[model samples]
Target: MPVDNHDHDHQDRFEERLGEALHQAGGAYETDRRALVAAGETRGHRLLLRRRAAVVAGVASVALVGLGGALLVPGGDDGRQSVATGAKTPVASATPKASYTGDELIGILEKLLPRGEFSSPQARGTDDRLPPYAQVVHDDGKGKAAVAVGFDRVLPGSEQARQTVECPDKVLTPYDGCVVSRLSDGSALRIFQGYEYPDRRADTKLWTADLVTPKGQHVSVSEWNAAAEKGAPVSRAEPPLSPARLRTLATAAAWLGVVDAIPVDPKAPTAAPAQPSGIDGGAIASTLVSLLPKGVKVVARSGPDSGYAYVVVDDGKGRSLVQINVQPNMSDVEDQLFGAGAETLADGTKVVTHKEPGEKGGAGVVMWTADTLRTDGFRVVVSAFNSGSQETAATRDAPALTTKQLRAIALSAKWRGLG
Candidate 1:
């Protein structure tokens, strides 16, 4: 979404002040400009990624977070760290998601292949504008498989988004830039890549290799380069298990939990106003603020774009932290998608990312960009972490959080309340 100055004096003032505040922050100017360049270059990246050239990583918000399924996490390098307990996730033997049907998958194939051929097309690397032949193959790791036959002027991502809309029976998860189907059989198939932000000129062919635990959770190894030529199809080694942990993977991606966790937008009017959760939006912000260094004075705000009343508390010093987001009881997948990080791992997934050098910050840092979703009646919680400690702190806490923590943060967090 692009920001426009609509001549609202209040908005203009806020923008003016915000800009001045950013300038005072110094490095934030660079961060903001770099973020802008990354955002604008999205479409251009897809245009240039087809040369099979080596790609480089750059700045991006919400880059993939890895839920590493390591066989044995080293404990303090002394070979004795007790691994942290597994985070709870949903699991069940999926028959294949009922949301999509076989016919829909075939339709997607028609667009990818030439006459939707079963075998590789006669032309190799020629500019004939070939269509890919899609198939629901086996052995693709997440329990099912899918393959696209060719790429003669075919950009996987542009096509993947189109296919997702038509194929409702499947779970469409985007990895790196390519897309994949989270099949009911507990497998994922690579489709194509989408546009990556920050530097479209950096690279294109996003690749993903998927693995689904017997318990049904998935893990993908995604790379944004020539996915096929430079890598193995899917390489994996089983992780030692806890039977209980395995059972959790079979369930859905916990979209329901995420829905249950979002706090209602304070700005949305009740027509029939939605029921208020026990906790209000302020708690989210307050909780967010509370998590920071003591004595850090913060200016707070509440908004609806994020599907959760979000609180961004900025310490008067150049550093900041996004503390809380509260959502009311709602049962929509779209909100869940927008509101929370992935609760379960999926196939064809990768953990690729980009960040500023010397900055070391990574995914999940709240930003002003999440604000635009509000116009559509969404709620957003935006937070900026203080420099240095920001990324180190968030990544460490992300996977350790339980469903209980997620819900409590939304339902019980207290904020500086004026909604």
Candidate 2:
């Protein structure tokens, strides 16, 4: 099936960073046809695993990472080339023809899997409208599992590439085990054992091996205990493939030829724009701490460089998590984020309060949010959770701060200094 764009866009920072890195590395895929198969596999794999993890913990910190703007390029037809917007030159001449079809690539994947009975096979050819991918339900005598493999690229020496191989902070992302290592061939590789949901509310497990060659060839292999990534029950204790097997699949030579067949978009490198300037996380956290109500004791704080900050506080009762995001020039999204129910103050500041369930679906965990926007396009949104992390159990019956207090803090004059 074609990848879901919605799900892809909402992936956690780790996956998104990897995607950006791959795009940068594969800028020359089209012109270099000597290794077409590898290119195709690389591109398809990147797209397929776009949202492999969206609800992971510590995503707030990850969002603070800076990235450049990106220019999206639509897939082109067989005989045509899609030129990137703002290109100063014409599209380059046709490169070598792709040697392998999508099915041929899938055939290569099937051959690489360990001895097993494969069923529910679905494969996309290299020439297909959507990025190509191969998926199957493999039974290795123990249980049936979903396994998939695809290809992508990353720019060597780019910030995106450097961040791609970095391990997620354990405090922000709770994982069973994660390893980053350099292969003998000098390729950077990461193996992660993590749950599909950061909260581990379900039994679904996702394991992946991400590899990027020095030349920017990217290959990712993923497996799950369920038949599908979501809406499926866990079929076994773990995925069918082991970390060793996943590494073997990702580093296979067969994929290199296929990756060369994948077309490259001239705009891939230009897609990411620079990060927006705003208040530093430390300042935001300090400001919030100073504005807290008396008798509330802060136990911990997070967000140093990010524009968002959070603190764990106790109010002679239980612990609560309070977080805030400070953004500038956000008038463009004012209407969408704040509706007609929002109130306007004498100072022309619009404010809205929301009481909703925790984003991670933790049982009995509630969230209270106060959103405020000044006429000058300054936005301050503060939220409090009954729990320290959305992935964990509720530590308090309610957030330490009331909605009124949250509203007051969000609209404080102290925030104007950040401007």
Candidate 3:
């Protein structure tokens, strides 16, 4: 996989500490419900949550993985229950876990990313240039599994600390499985394996773990780390992680301490004057889609804002919309765009989301709101939404648009019946 060493280095630092988390989980509730494992058999670190929250389908869900696909799903609301303070406890069992084949770890990994295949770790003698951050290891037994993931040369720090400013543009281009790009959160993940990388090596296992241990089975991360130390030159490949598991990784402060930050309210209603309107929904959706930057698409749209664009689409599944907006203004649309820390553009475009009032967790459309006076007399409002991912509520925002430009886009979108 073509991962940035900078990202790898950063992940390395964090993973090193990941070992200590084991002792924390060892103290309590070991007899509580066991980890949702794959049938039976296990190895490596046992994953149990004293309090693990599942991603609510509506508010926040898992997202597409791979290179380029690894972009941050804008900070938004999580419908899950509020978090409880505490680390997960290991499974309770007076008996020490008997060493088993490495299948148990493999199974946990398989669930974490079911789309993946199995393969041996990289052999030290291979002609392939191994990633310096490539450290793939697992325990033979002890029941439980945790893949010690790593990235090469990539910024190794908190997701918030590293913004997208460090990545290159072509990183997102095709022809390569992984394209490095900045995300709203600041951290950049190289989509390796088929997720995003050079070889797309739909051909390497790169990911490994032990078999699933029986439900009562569990192990600590520190214990697993010590055991994995005995293994060397583990495979280095981009492993496919389950969207759900990936969500846990992204939101878990322990792994990355990733917190969910969303602009519940708008940036405060802008002082900009309202423009004309009349462009219907169809016209608005068509024009907005046409005007969007490449690689951007529309997932959802609304009617025109009284006289401005009124819809936002994180992943443009189809067209755009124009509608009434009731959310507060976003702090800075452009800053949120182009990933975090993005400076204002020369055009002075304002990106905003049309959120439901009093709503929280970034649930709304994000687009450029605009109003234009059409020749027909019906004024129209339009919003171009084509940022973020489908899994995030940030898609509903629409801002930085004007009536005039919206009308132009609407004009182009006007349906002319074929003769």
Q: What's the lDDT for candidate 2?
A: 0.62
lDDT of 2 by residue, 37-113 (tens): 11111222221011212322122222212212222222321121222222111111144346667667667778988
The C-alpha local distance difference test score for the whole of candidate 3 amounts to 0.26
lDDT of 1 by residue, 150-238 (tens): 21111112222122111111001112332222333323222223222122232333332232322222222222222221222322221
Candidate 1 — which residues are off by over 4 angstroms? 1-225, 228-302, 305-309, 312-318, 325-419
What are the C-alpha RMSDs, in order, of all predicted structures? 24.5, 12.7, 20.1
Candidate 1 lDDT: 0.26
Runs of candidate 3 exceeding 4 Å displacement: 1-419
TM-score of each: 0.23, 0.71, 0.23
lDDT on C-alpha atoms for all candidate structures: 0.26, 0.62, 0.26
Q: Pick the TM-score winner.
A: 2
**Which runs of model 2 end up more than 4 angstroms from their true locations?**
1-99, 153-173, 182-187, 213-216, 270-272, 297-300
